[model samples]
Target: MDDIVRQALAKWPDVPSCTGWLLLDRRGNWRMRDEAAQAGGAAGTPIRHTALLAFINRNYEADESGQWFFQNGPQRVYVELAYTPWVVRLSADAGGALSLTDQAGGVFEPSAVYVDDEGGVLFVDRSAPPRVAVLHDHDLEVFSDHAQLADDGVSGAFFWRDGVALPLQAVRRADVAGRFGFVVSPATRA
Candidate 1:
């Protein structure tokens, strides 16, 4: 197994067993939403969403977009949702028409939700050639090099916000092996 994955597993044994999804709403607040029961209507154990939010809030600063990191005890796991190019079929009744798009586009009409192996649903837009919709589907792992403590005594990656150098620490270590940091955003921090 990858070192980061092994490390994450060692630290967070319950990760794989975690079935529900975690969300960062438009307000930049953290919320853990549980998945509904299967065919039998048997619900899985529910985790305290508030508890997780409080935990991340205390450890990391919430940006304007409400972006935050995830931590398991002492190890920080960077959790991010990524958008992938996919084709969606509109008007599925008659086998529908197909269009390609990413996560930024709005919803499409008469589209079938395709759940990938990773439990992420693929949203497609039939109206446009490229469909767009924000997807919080995939669990992307990100890591950081050794961080130096800032004036606040927090260790995080150094970045510039509004032209001022800001200290950003890892709230979540997405990588299990911890080799390289996961680059979730299109823009580079450094």
Candidate 2:
């Protein structure tokens, strides 16, 4: 959290939270939904401002109920998730080691990997309250190159550059939010 935001919260502690106004898309894009967009169930306009994006990323957090939000100074702007709370992109280090980086630019060290029924990949970090991140669609090819499927075609293992093969688990898309403890749409919860 930013010092300025903390000060604002201290000054005005009763600011009501805003929802159905901001969204985090599956491709890691931040979107701003207007009234019309929200009413029509549209994805809204993509937020391209670099500074604003950085600020939102810096203050992003999740509540105890697993509702993700951006602490915008005094008011909490809840984020409507298009998929998981995070969308992670796969990158290779100088040593050709695989690594994961979330849309917010935070390094995500995945402790487990899961493949959904639709073939979508998800990475779960080792945090106490583990976070689940969907693999960016663009990085699917790269991910496939490092993964080996088992004879059953459902199970697999991801081979990292260090020669450690992390076993992959199968997950159903519908069960993801419940299994991971996150709300896909916080606005609906309200």
lDDT of 1 by residue, 66-151 (tens): 23234444343333323332222222123322222222232344232333333233333345333323234221110111123444
User: Candidate 1: lDDT of 21?
Assistant: 40
Q: Distance from true position, residue 76, model 2, in Å?
A: 0.6
TM-score of each: 0.23, 0.95
Worst 10 residues of 1 by lDDT: 138-147
Q: What tens digits encode model 2's per-residue C-alpha lDDT throughout 60-80?
A: 999999999999999999999
Quote the positional error of residue 155 for candidate 2 in Å: 0.8
Tally clashes: model 2: 0
Superposition-based RMSD of candidate 2 using all C-alpha atoms, in angstroms: 1.6
Error at 50, model 2, angstroms: 0.8
lDDT of candidate model 1 versus the reference: 0.32
Please tell me which predicted candidate would have the highest TM-score against the true structure: 2
Which residue runs does candidate 1 get wrong by more than 4 Å?
Answer: 1-20, 37-52, 59-69, 74-190
